[model samples]
Target: MNSVMITGCSSGFGLETARFFFEKGWHVIATMRKPDNSLFPTSDRLSILELDVTDQNSIDRAVREAGPIDVLINNAGIGYMSPFENTSDEIVHKLFDTNTFGTFNMVRAVVPQMRGRKAGTIINLSSSTTLKPLTFMSTYTASKAAVTAYTECLALELAPLGIRTVLIIPGLSPSTSFGKNAGDKISKSGEPADEYKALMEKVQSEFQREMLVQELTKPEDVVNAIWQAVTDSNCPVCLPAGPDAVALSQ
Candidate 1:
């Protein structure tokens, strides 16, 4: 049975992708910051592991324990939403650490094994905001944009090695916890205060109305995109998930 190792399976896209692969009869190594058996059904084909993508040692240890994986999905990431000026330096570092360098660390840890075996698929989750800019999401967009660019370069570099690099650009997803998490992070950082408060509110309200007109991307849409990225050898280097993403791609 082909095995896949996924990071950030605690929730959101990572959790859904883990279940999707397991249902397809693939051995799944689901890595989260905190492993919770209750989150998924018990199966011999499923193994829950603890991993912190921002930590190189954690990534290396998880990859070593996973043995040889046919696929690696870099889905563990954090989001920040605030004016670039209001976004603290610490927030920038933290966001990049998880969303950008975290991906880099995971790739570094697993690519050696994939290279030795001469085959593998690596999928990185990015955001559609990278395609069409969004207000107050500059830092988050920049981080995901980095992932998109890195994956493109990686695909070219790994082509001769028989490895595939895919980037999944998903649109705004209300079903995911990402927005809530981002809001919480912004609150903790005390953003949108003083001069930026009114502008932030206006932008957020406008964005919400825009979302209503555009079809929101579902979890299933993302899952299907990921499946295509993994199984379809002819899939494009960048696969857009959901209507907004498709629109942005065009």
Candidate 2:
């Protein structure tokens, strides 16, 4: 049976992907920052481990523990909300650390093993926002854009080695905690926003309308894309998941 490793498996796309792969007979190594704090229901084929993607030692340990993985799903990410002028260096760096740098660290840790096997796939969880930018989310959009560009480069570079890199761009999924968590994080950041509060709130509301109220997509949408990326022999290099994604791709 094929075995896969997915980061940020505690929730959202990561958790759904792990469960989907497990049900499909793939041994899934689900790595979260806190294994014990997993919110997803447990399973026998799912092996949970603590893996902070920003830390090299954590990546090394998880890589070693996962053994031979046929696919690596880099799904860990954090979000931020602020206008370009209001975003602090600290918040911007935090978003990059988890979304961009974390993804790079995971790729670096797994690429060597994939190279040895000469057969593996890397699926990056990118954002549909890369197609269109919204206000107050410049930093978050930029981070996903970075991932999209990096994955495009990796697809070509790793192809000769018999490895594939696929970009799984997800639109908005309402059944996930992504929006709630993002709102909470921004609320806690305590950024000074007297005039921008209305604008930020408007942006946040629109994000919710698209992602949650409309139910534009579900976790299963992403799981299906991920399955196709890892198992389908003729899958495209970049697959967008969800209805919004399909519309955007057009």
Clash-forming residue pairs, model 1: none
Candidate 1, 1-250: lDDT as tens digits: 9999999898888999999999999999999887999999988899999998877888878888888899999998887777887788888887898899999999988888889989999999999999989888998999999999999999999989989999999988887777554443334566455888888889989978977787978888999999999999999999999988999999
lDDT of 2: 0.83
Tell me the TM-score of model 1.
0.95
TM-score per prediction, in order, is: 0.95, 0.91
Q: lDDT by residue for model 2 over 52-71, one digit each (tens)?
A: 88789999998998888889
Worst 10 contiguous positions by lDDT, candidate 1: 179-188
- Local accuracy by lDDT, each model: 0.89, 0.83
How far is each candidate from the true structure, as Cα RMSD in Å? 1.7, 2.4
Model 1 misplacement above 4 A: 179-187, 191-193
Least accurate 10 contiguous residues by lDDT in model 2? 179-188
